[model samples]
Target: MSGSWAGGRFGERGECLLAPNPGIMTLDGTNTWVLREPGSSTAVVVDPGPVEDGHLERLDEETGDVGLVLLTHHHLDHSEVAATFAARKGCAVRALDPAHCVGADPLADDEVLSVGGLSLRVVATPGHTADSVSFLLPTERVLLSGDMVLGRGTTVVAHPDGRLGPYFDSIERMRSLATAGEVATIWPAHGPVHDDAGAVLDHYLAHRRDRLAQVAAAVERLRDEGATPTPRAVVEVVYADVDEILWGAAELSVRAQLEYLAERAS
Candidate 1:
């Protein structure tokens, strides 16, 4: 909230229109990306964002001709108005999940989508949610990392549909892309855009490892005390310094960590 991340234009092909919905979970707001290749007549929209009147009006102005609407994930904030926006623009909305896609095939891993001479490679970076996916714009060396990587802080590995192991793999995948110079920047869904994709990814991975260790230590101490630690109990100890309003999100991460530990032990 204190940063200069008011979300604006990136390189030549990308422009971010920050949504109006700002809160604890969604930092700033959802970033609606307008992507257009140089000398192209049509634009490709990514994550139409929550259906806000003012935001939508601004977005409509920013993107005069949209050839396609793409969702980073099935998250309501990211995809709730994708269908409506796409319908209004006379374009198809495509996502990994069938329930959210409209008039387009489900996105496949490593699929290259070319519209208006712009190429977007679908990199299946799930684990924030099973339907989560990141787009790799090889031209700009940028990754539109849905909820996998954030600009300000770390991301939550939501339990149930979101698992730790896959999140680990997904981060590693992005890391490889960064190290290989295929991706230099990360355009996250929630926060601002990251120019240092490698550094940001490394920080994200390190934070996860450190938090997992902390959770394991807490779990061990609780077990030694003959107490079975629930997710909330683990959160109480591990995330004592964090805001209580975020304990619910921290609990989700703790649950994922516990599940990872259990799987490792097994």
Candidate 2:
């Protein structure tokens, strides 16, 4: 039991089954969500999580007769076992990316899917990755925030597949959802459930802004010293506080920051 998670039932129709693959990156491991309507025979599982046999067995025991499998993104940790698991459960796997889906079409924005009687409205929130998405469960006012939002700390907007502009837009969209009273809680894919949706969104937005500003300042300082302000150089100055193991992840975000700055200049 990590300080950030305790695997428990959340909202009116969801439960979290914490995976065994916890680490510096995946805090308390990946969260496999099981959602079902009251007295409904069918359930929907989200983020099947790595292809670990024990994890799959635990999920099978925790969620019986799964009707649909939903994926937030194509990250291996979250989507590796999805197709196999969905096949085992006799269900269709739907994701934003066609390659990740099995025997079903990719999801679209505002697309609503049902499991028994509960519904999940797909919210396209690409930032963490181009295919990243979040689900809004209107009945419980809970949002299944994939990697777009984490239950603890902040998320990395790694480059190539991630962009600062779209990431900010996605967070703003989620904030708008909270402001409109469409969502009140966050059912993140990692860590524990967040009770205050408004505060979490505010923090996520603030943290991204703060980090970008800090990275910008670092870039300026590096340039003043007549040195190249590359992503690795910027990481040394901006991500000094982060562990060396996470420097690789930090560098990825730094790359995205550099691209965003370059676009602004252009």
Off by over 4 Å in 2: 1-4
Error of 1 at 24 (Å): 0.9
Give the Cα-based TM-score of candidate 2 against the true structure. Answer: 0.97
Q: What digit string (tens of lDDT, one per residue) describes model 1 on residues 139-208?
A: 8999999888877898988887899999999999999999998999999998888889999999999999
Error of 1 at 92 (Å): 0.3
Provide C-alpha RMSD values for all models, in order: 1.2, 1.4
Residue 211 accuracy (lDDT) in model 1: 98
Compared with the true structure, all predictions reach lDDT values of 0.90, 0.90
TM-score, candidate 1, is: 0.97
**In candidate 2, where is summed lDDT lowest over 10 consecutive residues?**
1-10
The CA root-mean-square deviation of candidate 2, after full C-alpha superposition on the true structure, stands at: 1.4
Clashes of 2: 0
Q: Give stretches of model 1 more than 4 Å off.
A: none
Q: Lowest summed-lDDT stretch of 10 residues in model 1?
A: 1-10
For model 2, which pairs clash?
A: none
lDDT by residue (1-266, candidate 2, tens digit) is 13757678986798898888888888988999999998998999999999765998888777988999999999989998898899889999999999988999999999999779889999999999999999999999999999888888888896889999999999999999999999999999888788889999999999989999999999999989999998999999998988889899999888998899889999
